[model samples]
Target: MLAVQHCNNSALHVDEGFSNQTQQVLGVAPVRCRENLNTTTNPTAAGLSMTLGIVSNIIALIILAKAYARLRKRSKATFLLFASSLVATDLAGHVIPGALVLRLYISGTAGGLCNQSDATCHFLGGSMVFFGLCPLFLGCVMAAERCMGVTRPLLHARMVCTAHTKIVLVMIWLLALSVALLPFFHLGTYIYQFPGTWCFINVLDNTSITDVIFVLLFSGLGLAALAVALVCNTISGVTLVIARLRKKKCHRRSAKSHDIEMVAQLVGIMVTSCICWSPLLIFGLMSVIRSYSGSMGDDLETYRTLMVMGVRLATWNQILDPWVYILLRRAVLKKIYRITTGRSDLKGSTFRRWEISSFQNSMKSVINRN
Candidate 1:
């Protein structure tokens, strides 16, 4: 994410100075208005991604509910908690919002998805603004928590609790909303840009101040949050490795094979985070700068295609999250598989008591499903 933000800044600074007066580029013009300031994307692609996201989110929700039920009264894994949360918010911010935009475009809603009312736009925009930073901040929090767990394991157990976690969550919500909502407050334009097929905070008002605020909220603050998370996470992962080596030197039992497996699962989760999110960090600033500076060409169309692809990548996190958690914790997979198969696995469980009881108990509710 740091790399992406740096790359975006490098591209923008090289092409156009920060002066807004010299930058009079147009925004997404999906109408017949040949005056300028327009762009377009395939509603088909948007719709398809939305469909996939919705399906994925639904699956994740089911798998998670069963897992939670099965794990009740057990020592729940923190990464599992983080993964569950991140997936939920990813759907809210990226996938579902994108779906709404595409729905409006297909329905030919003239003023975006606000029912052509400023009030609705404000509600929608504020909603989008409020939840917008969720995935980014959630990722960071997950990473930070993971790092602290590895670096300061004893502290992790003592410092964090349901109440403390809730407080932290409240703070994250307040902070993200405070930063993202700043634009709506200052611009007094909540649903700033609809552009027919996609929606974003419009930065192309008469003053172009909207553009700056949009850039700052989505790019500036989003990048900062991601950077902090990535640094903490990277440190945590490295420390895990170091700790393992020291444990080996001391001839103390390192992380058990199962524990190592769990870390591997979390690593996959983190890698997907980078894949889905980094592109958005890089392209968001570049796209805005290009829009501001009139630097886009036919090749720029290709870039826009990639940008949309990147945004979709973030959306995929919602769907992929279920699998990540299931892979980390077997109970989730057991429940999902039982739900699909309609019967518990009778194939032959030669496993030990703890594993068998956990899987069977998890599958009990699942097997009873329709």
Candidate 2:
């Protein structure tokens, strides 16, 4: 800890590197963090991350509120309701540590309190692992659900039992959390290194087998989630397309169309997940597995730097989440329109609705190709 002037008559122990140093506050010491590092060209990725986070939370909150109002009576499992939990966790994973880092960064890079000791780190660590896993696996589970719904409507409707859905969802979250923490409990901590943040724990400094294991384990997890999302999304798209073509002669076309809508949204969800995390996931595996895989160490620092950037980009998910809701779930945008306008915006011309629908379909097709 370093001593700097206080707003009051007294001076205080504060990390000065992150601060503008223009003024002081009473009894408040600025937390030191890595954000003091140069971000001149970066737009304070943390700041952008925060803005994205705020927007997403607002959108999600709006959607949930509207959904509660609209389907207030329906106890069925809707995407908005189920995905809300994931949204909450993602917000925490992205925001809590991000805020802390920004604070420390502005205070001064030299030193500051980080995680109130190791226990706190574990909490953040566990939170990151838990939340990160929940979204990806949930996407996969969701894809399976969509496939059943479109491919086997009767079975899908019957299988929509609350008990089963709840059980599967809970298990998914638990398994993801457990998988993330195995390395930590076995030996060390999971770490995070973005452009301006490093949560979980300090990295490579420990150099224990446990540390390396945790790194591989978490990275592997990220990669797995991305892969599952891609494969499931592709299959879901193809399956839905086939189902629609086969049922063209029946009056079930509209129903089939709705099924396709759901599938497209599900695919969009996974595509977004893949785009957000794939780069980091790929590089993370290489870094962790290099010892066993071939050599690429001639540019280790470059790769490390790339890993940092990739992880930062991965966080785009949190920021993009609100937009995702608006596009993928009708509930969110409807609410946004209603709240902002004194009247309903859904009463647009038939042409407008068709346009919106067409845009969504095109986006799904393109995202699927990616």
What lDDT does each candidate get?
Answer: 0.55, 0.56
* Displacement of the residue 368 alpha carbon in candidate 2, Å: 36
Q: Residues 1-370, candidate 2, lDDT per residue (tens digit)?
A: 0011111212233444435243234445544343323422232655665766766767776776666565432322444455665566666766665665556556543122332234444555566566666777777777667667656767876676556777887888788867757755656554434332344433422245565666676767667766766776677688766655665656342233345545667767777887876776666656655633445547555665766666566667666655665576544445666777766655673324544654565466558668
* TM-score to true structure, per model: 0.65, 0.68
lDDT of 1 by residue, 115-173 (tens): 12354455555655555477667767877776776677679867866566667777877
Candidate 2 residues lying further than 4 Å off, grouped into runs, are 1-45, 68-76, 106-123, 190-196, 200-208, 247-252, 291-297, 329-370
Which structure among the candidates has the greatest TM-score? 2
Clashes of 2: 10
Report how far off residue 199 is in candidate 2 (Å).
2.9
Candidate 1 residue pairs in clash (backbone atoms < 3 Å):
26-37, 27-37, 27-38, 28-38, 28-39, 29-38, 29-39, 203-210, 203-211
Model 1, runs deviating above 4 Å: 1-47, 69-77, 94-99, 102-106, 110-131, 187-195, 203-207, 247-249, 256-262, 290-307, 328-370
- Tell me the TM-score of model 1: 0.65
What is residue 10's positional error in candidate 2, in angstroms? 30
What's the lDDT for residue 290 in model 1? 65
